[model samples]
Target: MVSSVLQWSIFMSIFSSICCLRRDYFITAEEHWWDYAPSKQNLITNDRTISDRLIQTTEYRIGSVYKKVKLKQFTDGSFRREIKPAPWMGYVGPTIKGETGDVLYVHFRNLASRPYGLHPHGVQYFKDSEGSLYMDGTSGRDKLDDTVPPGYTYTYRWSMLNTFAPTKDDENCVPVGYHPHVRSTKDIDTGVVGILLICKPGTLNPDNSRKDVDREFVLYADTVNETNSWLIDQSLNLCLNPQRCRQLFNQKNEAFITDTLMYSINGYIYGNLPDFPVYEGEKVAFYAMGLNLGLHVFGVQGQSFTFKRKRTHAVVFGIAWFQGLYMTTRNPGRWMIFCKVNYHFNRELYYRLSGMNTHCYSYCYNN
Candidate 1:
């Protein structure tokens, strides 16, 4: 009788462990209209004038203008379908969560017109679930899951093995990005990017929320080339009118394109970036990455951060990669976090504060 009871207990434990080892995510690829800048103002310099700024600086185009493009993004199965919605609501994809030793079963449905696939980084997938197409010398059934056509669905199985797990020094959450490989450049440039976050085992609560973190912010600093933007001509015509676009493109196409390059933080320019709210003394983590081109300098006025165990005022010379900072909100006040790069600063790659009461308005003018 004692031996039988022990065996039953062991079996129950094993079954519970197996149940915790699997995480399934339902993701859908759909087309939606994303507003790069919603606040119809110069977020960089707070300039209210529109005519002169719009003509000279491509960074100032505001309002319900700009042509609507079919940007491919990942949405949760229950996410509502909308045209131009906030970034958090399926514009930049859902924040994927998983744990070490867990298997991620992603049911991906492609609703876009083009063929696309979900290729993830820092994870393990078999050849049939690679979600990428290349000359990898594989044939027959091995490459069947490379790209999923429009109106088709494919299930990608990814394993977060211990080999690819986060290191001890890594924060509770780590970021992973996924995009389509069919037309890599155009797809990413036209906004096919989404974020995936993997957490350490037992770091997430029963409700799938991060533990011991009050607030988390992920910033993708990117320079979007207007010429390569999806529906560039249509966007220009809608924003600046047909005759004006013709004149501008004819005389100074290169300059116009250069000026139109959107230096944005999470697709928001000027001060259109949303405010980050947090209470005093809460733990905060900022995950930053630079996409596309140019150097990104992330700075938060009135606060010092700890990056890699060193104290720094800002993350200087942030390249096109991932960099993280963990800090405690000891100093209470509304602060400004902006990119220190000259062009990015001038283009309004920053976010304003609404809460807290730290008096350091000097940093705003220094930019």
Candidate 2:
């Protein structure tokens, strides 16, 4: 009987080793790789649902105002009406028109620092095809569509959109506010999901500056990922390219946390990239390296990182990033990087071949 028990234990050990060796290959035995691609399904809130209101009937209601402030001058001798963004918050819209339902397009700096929600004015004509519009200060990054860090050096632009229906409501839009799915509580400065635009009361044609604003700057938010199965960008690639960014998981079971790097600027969080192979209760350390545009390196002076668990599932590991000024002459500039790195799985090392987006949207924010 004792011999039989010993034999069973040995078999179990061998099975566990096999599982670890082929972890990534088998992690999705039940799901196909193409299943990770983005879906065309629109994300609408309960407020935008068919039952939310009269669907076939076009609604032309009076526009509402929450906070109205006007500024004709700035200390810098500018005729622009500029408003400062709140602490770490921002606001967009009113897309104001007078009582007649004309459209006014407005842009704000540091919108993440204000308190404006999506609001619609004028007579809105309902159509079968739906699309949504929102105010974003992060320029194109407001879409929250990319998997790369936001603080990177890139050419950025801001715009707004007024989508119709069935295609453009927030996936989680409710009566009071709308949620941009890509941003988690960790990324946002405020916990509130701001207001969403209902339809304006008319056919949505413009006359003058209001027309140009509507034509040039319709408030629009980028779509966010709806599945937990994959991230915004999940193209698997070799980590050897400095310009390539991708999501990866351990290829083995016994991996433990190894290193982390978190960098900050003026008390603002810039970036945090980690390396791993970590286990519970294990202490890992790393350096926070900063680089200027000139390629000069600066250490945090005297700071080494230690791991802390914020989630119940995965173990925290290491973080790292490169800080530098990259120069370009054109509107949309390209930055090049050189990196040589490989991965170690189950005592075997594997290198990535390339970094690619698993969805329809490539890393176009670089645009």
Candidate 3:
């Protein structure tokens, strides 16, 4: 019952923050090419999964690079200078931070070719601030917030309500995801999503950084169905056999479509995420978010973390479920962090995988 209440459960923490403040974030939806396997080689299984037929520039595959629409942050309304995200954040947008009673001002811009809007769950907003389009009995200017046209900017004001805030038993902070609702599922597949952290009083520094945590890692896992991407046509055009790729797409070929799925953690595949160092004994927190289809069992290779007073090495959740895991760095050396769902752990990035096995793409891995 407790698990079901928290839509996508956020993890454990410690606290500080006193005053209610207004936090503003300037965000833009931009189009660019994202390389899942940046190294062009599998790093998790030591490249054992690398096969000529399975990845990159082959007679059929376009490799790991794909055109995507990502939510990028800028300094302000001008949308000129871009704000860099954490090294390990991968493709996710900058984390928005605040305390209970604080108000959030999200200045969203649609710089991409298509229209987009910012819709967040677990927050309080009015009709004009609501970024999702629906028959809410609203019209004219009120509906503009539903989908900001390309080259337009919309401001969504969301309040961190006590009702939606972390429970008293919840350690320090809580997390929720914010993404576009213009096309909902299709928008997420296009790669525009970010995290929102709401904390108790005094839990965060003035800069919004956590006070007690020495290391923080936010990992979002999902099987990106390239078929749903708005850039699908563009991707097909870049394929080795454009006509064949288009045929597969038009026919809705299950085998060919499934082959384009990318099992990723922060938009990276096969242990290719950027390095985020954690020293021994440092207080570390791992926030894992799982989406789309398939159940995920997130496991830490060596150490165990505490969740809801339970000490375990893994946390399980499926679509629309998320977990907050925190652990001190104890076991040394490099370890692996991947979705422990049987074949997903083994055959996910195992390139030579043939046949019409659609389940193969439903799994993802990283180290």
Candidate 4:
């Protein structure tokens, strides 16, 4: 049955891999030209996979650009605008010049201040003797006026998408639950850059029930100046709701248990669900938001307008059906449990549990 499932899966021409790990599955392949373009159709309907194609494409070439800069305040108190040389920005294509495609344009900006309304835009694309990767395409600032608000910093970046698709299996996406993985700088530069505004938790996208509730912690990612360019690293964790993470798994992993936690949040021993533990004896609403800029051309932010964080109000909802379980000890570690649950409001609730541990541990379970 597993073989049949694998056979029926979309075939990754650009990215291909053969599992080599015994306990955990690993797909490795030589990078190819087409691996950069991952399409929604292919991922949703085709026989091809993403990782296989990206790895295969990288064999021919690997390209990336980076820029680091400091911000300046406006004397007039309006906003600042000056495109100076970034720390570094360029393309990593084939060694041969003629072998490369047009230099993919990467633009940067900062707009994470007040909630201004803007549209979604495009992604950057580069083609060379080897192939291409689609990246950095965004819309104008969420709102396009220079009304700098207090505690707002923005960063904008751009890149290219050589192929038609938008995702590849080989791509190392920001892992959920880790903030830096999705926002901070790292060895590899992913197509995401923008300003980070230090605002009240509920200011950007707040929940009325939780608004003014300073006891909980909220973590989210947004593009600042340019539509997209994010600095991230492996050590930096990706924050994801336990329920949504479980949904990524099979049904066997979706069951719920009250005695144990389903997933970890902020590296804490808890489940990734609605109203999970934010700290000891303190549980707050947990959510996972999938932000997208929609289809773009040539990877630019002119048309950008859309951003979402799943189904919760304000497009942010809690992970309910899919869940995870984790336990910690004096020696912090993680464990996964395949469990199921009955859900209400299509959101995952919280449960507490105890486990066999020589050290003190906290747990979160859901149903």
Candidate 5:
């Protein structure tokens, strides 16, 4: 009996270990041309008349220019050569998914013209995987992973430690971000950022789809400085007028830069964002991350969501931060999800709501 029990115990231990095995993801940082605003007709309008006559147009010429930048992404493993859509529409990197107690093996390849590295937030890693160049106690190869030069590759192993798991009051899935740490500000501004989703055990399927929610949306709010467009060769050539690039850059035109600064959601400005689809009763999770400077307040008109049983209409003061919201698709209609800041609201930071039926079942308050 003792020998039989020992064999069973060992078998159970092996099965548990297999169940806790980590997952691997291969991501590459490649430069790609991205059209920041794809809409031919701008949705922004000014009611003021010019000399008592109406002067209306649908184009914000400078803000709608295209640019090339490095983005972190994964390929679909296709054998035939085909043009792939920018990963996550070129706004952010593909969502890296894992669960509590799982390990994430990210093999990063830098295919851009300059050096960049992947640094993750809210994960466990040794000095070699930290992805930032600095004088730490470590020496030798430990510093090599910090800055991945162009044409090089680095593998970073990060463990989703239990400490970052969801608490009792928190949602089943937690959100984290990964971005280039080499020349942090410049790299981030040049479009090297992505999302990481760490879920509770059993909350995510083996394919990384969330079992608890019917749909998920990741929204990144950022202010893109168009003045930096000249830094990339493709953007300079794609300028509305090639000579305009020289004029803007050589003259150090501040007014033109300020006017062209785009307040964008997911690399889309104005009403260029696609409509989010959802069923009437399904659960929806909205994950938001604010990038760069300035205070950003996100609000959804004609709808309200509950956080901790407190009704809130908007994500207030979500400046250079990350937050998530879970809401039932109760009140569905053509709602407006927009930034409430005066500058952003009046500019091009709004998206239309569609494919939702109106059904208000819970109490909600307005902002």
Candidate 6:
């Protein structure tokens, strides 16, 4: 029998190289100070009264602190150990997991001050790990990952091929995003970005998690545009009248760029995102990305989800794209997830989806 079919193809190629794996992360590209209202109070108007229009600081509204440049993660590669995410993951990044035949190895490093790198989108890499730049001609070390200045270091190396798996009708896990393509919209408006996922075969857990999900969130949605921040001139010196924020930023006016553009998520706003526990029946998921800078509609207020296969209650995307919503929590209590448009639902995000509602709310609750 052809020697037992070549010994069962060498025992399924040594059991697919002992159940594939690689994973390493250790990212970086720092720079601090964020605070999109760290309870500088206003849980839907519990109010701290600076005439709370969602934490107003006036003079030209630089209100919610700034000066970003994120993409941190590090727990190794001696980038000192830091893994603290969850203040509703604002300033994004961190969450680069894998599984589809696994293999990642990021290891970036650029301690921020300018130049950046680390691309990612799905998987499989080439062109020296394409970290985005134009002229793909291939010179020197294949263009040192496009641009990784400031106290440098770079690695990239992705792999997850099986055509990047997941599609028996999808959903065994599958996200996609990563940023700082050097000048990619000023390095994602100076906040870098992240979220990768992957998964499938046997559906993870050797600590890759998701043995069928039990709470996971990522909700991106952007439009942060803090005037193309690179610390927009040191955040116009934390404005309170940095010459009327350089005269309404040289009159970019549209009501002062609609009170300093920030209709966010994973970057907080209004409700100041921070409160996530979710109990009742569990299962949960919620990946839902964006950044093509247009529509949003993502929703939730008590429950009803499944998206893409449709059981919907809201899932309209845009902001580059990527979606995966799923729910199982059978109504808990303090809900609210948000972005149903209507001016994104409230603190005036450029008002008028028939009179704004600006909701950046986030609250899952259990305690």
Q: How far is candidate 4 from the true structure (C-alpha RMSD, Å)?
A: 24.2
**What clash count does candidate 2 reach?**
52
CA deviation > 4 Å runs, candidate 5: 1-19, 44-63, 70-72, 75-90, 240-244, 357-367
- Per-residue lDDT of candidate 4, residues 268-354 (tens digit): 111221222223222222222113211111100111111221221122223211111111111123322111222211111122222
Predicted candidate 5 versus true structure: per-residue lDDT over 198-300, tens digit per residue: 7888998766789988878888888866555424445555545757755765677775456556677777766666666666777778777776656787777
Model 1, 148-201: lDDT tens per residue? 888787878777766777789777667767767766655666666666677788
Candidate number of the best lDDT: 3
Error of 1 at 90 (Å): 8.5
The runs of at least 3 residues in candidate 6 whose Cα sits more than 4 Å from the true structure, single-residue gaps closed, are 1-41, 50-54, 64-97, 103-116, 119-127, 130-139, 148-157, 160-189, 198-201, 204-211, 219-242, 246-265, 270-279, 285-331, 335-367
Q: Each prediction's Cα RMSD?
A: 8.1, 29.5, 9.3, 24.2, 8.4, 15.8
The C-alpha lDDT values of all candidates are: 0.63, 0.20, 0.73, 0.20, 0.67, 0.72
List model 3 lDDT by residue over 338-358, tens digit each: 677875675342121111112
Which structure among the candidates has the greatest TM-score? 3
The ten-residue window of minimal lDDT in model 3 covers 349-358
lDDT of 6 by residue, 19-76 (tens): 6777898888889988776766555544344315335666767777778978888778
Write down the worst ten-residue block by lDDT for model 1. Answer: 55-64
Positional deviation of 148 in candidate 4, in angstroms? 13
Ranking by lDDT: 3, 6, 5, 1, 4, 2
TM-score of each: 0.78, 0.17, 0.87, 0.20, 0.81, 0.37
